[model samples]
Target: MKYKKYLSILVISVLIVSCAKNPFTGKSTMALVPNSQILPMAFQQYDQFLSENNVVTGTAQANMVKNVGQKISSAAERWLTANGYAGYLKDYRWEYNLVQDETVNAWCMPGGKIVFYTGIMPIAQDEAGVAAIMGHEVAHALANHGQQRMSASQIQQVAAVGLAVGTAGSENAAIYNQAFGVGSNVLGMLPFSRSHESEADKIGLTLMAIAGYDPLIGARLWERMSQQGGDAPQEFLSTHPANQTRIDNIVKWAPDARAVARKFGVTSFKN
Candidate 1:
């Protein structure tokens, strides 16, 4: 019981002390790891990953990736500047690459490093589709989801250690430890990840709209992905929201996105 009390105090202290505000969401998020440290590591890893993979260059598709990245990132900056957060992305080193891989995926790392797999291009079909994906990926970086994810993982690891220590010498110590691992992952980590995805979806839609792409494009892209025919994990066990859930969220949020874009003199959308 004493060990549990100390563990709880330690966790609470860390949570209170190590938080950063997410400009996009206007929410305070966990940031146990500082970006000053995370950015250099991210830059190095991005360079290494590019070196190890077949990075496509000198192609129209590659140019589109660069263009879309720039547009979405610029839109993000515009929003920030309009909202009195000028230079918020000063430390971000934005770079985009298209790699020759068949995985239908795209991701952005900490500090604005981004990659788009060649396989996802077909589903994207056009520039607007690309913008949708770009906006979402860039939103992840802008909102510092990577930092939150890392902080959450650190907390999870610490909690595991706490569980083990607190359960020491108990008859069901092993069982307690196993349950803690599974319960924390499913109940805490999974929900945390899903919330990030949804937040990204909302932010990305607004960004795409501000970048002059139709915000509804995000929902369309997901609809196409859903038709690609694969089973998604149950929502409770998945790190991302279900495909239908994402589509509905984007659709519901599209009008709001357009309204946001209008605040920046963007009255038209492109598809």
Candidate 2:
């Protein structure tokens, strides 16, 4: 029975590791939640959020959010289709809304439900800037960052349970506690969030470029964001990287993004 349990654990670990892959970067990633299960939940939660929030109605900014979403969604579809992932978004109910919030934030849910805060508009400055933020948020969804996070959380929970079980009658209780603390610290946060941010930046830049928006403008958007005072915290203290780091990275990667965009006949951006 003990051997069977160990074998089962090994097999499950291998399967979990095999199931995840970074679609844009082509890297072997770790995802515990599958899209088949996550998407419906995300869509339902998104609907709930929209119903509860004050969504802008019939305004030009609201319409622009929808328009930008459609363009980015189309670009995602084309990219996925060309990469032999046709019909990947068939179940996605793409919806974009501008919310009346002072927070400068935007995010895309798993099924393509996107929300942009009104406060972000000034920083976005123009259509291209909006596209840059939208593209980044949409890239997070396309990359399944949320699902990966959920999966990681699950694994952490299982590991915690396993540790408790293994250390249940042990003389080395202190060692077990210390180990658990360290494991929890590493597993619960930090590295995974950073990875998601990086992936979003790369995929978002590519998406914006493919949507005929200048990828270079992504840097400008971040620079403006850094200038916003008061409630906004310093760059290093935030979940996102420093503004200068992001700007430099975007500038460095813009050429590659443009090259990728050219494959989709988006050789230039509208000035």
Best by TM-score: 1
TM-score of each: 0.96, 0.86
> Highest lDDT among the candidates is held by which one?
1
lDDT of 2 by residue, 109-162 (tens): 988989999989988978898999999999988887887777766766665555
Q: Rate the local accuracy (lDDT) of all candidates.
A: 0.92, 0.81
Q: Cα deviation in Å at residue 195, candidate 1?
A: 0.3
TM-score of 1: 0.96
Supply the global lDDT for candidate 1.
Answer: 0.92
Write candidate 1's Cα lDDT for 219-243 as tens digits.
Answer: 9999999999978899999999999
Would you list the clashing residue pairs of candidate 1?
Answer: none
What's the CA error at residue 186 for candidate 2, in Å?
A: 4.4
Q: Lowest-scoring 10 consecutive residues by lDDT in candidate 1?
A: 1-10
Model 1 misplaced regions, further than 4 Å: 5-17
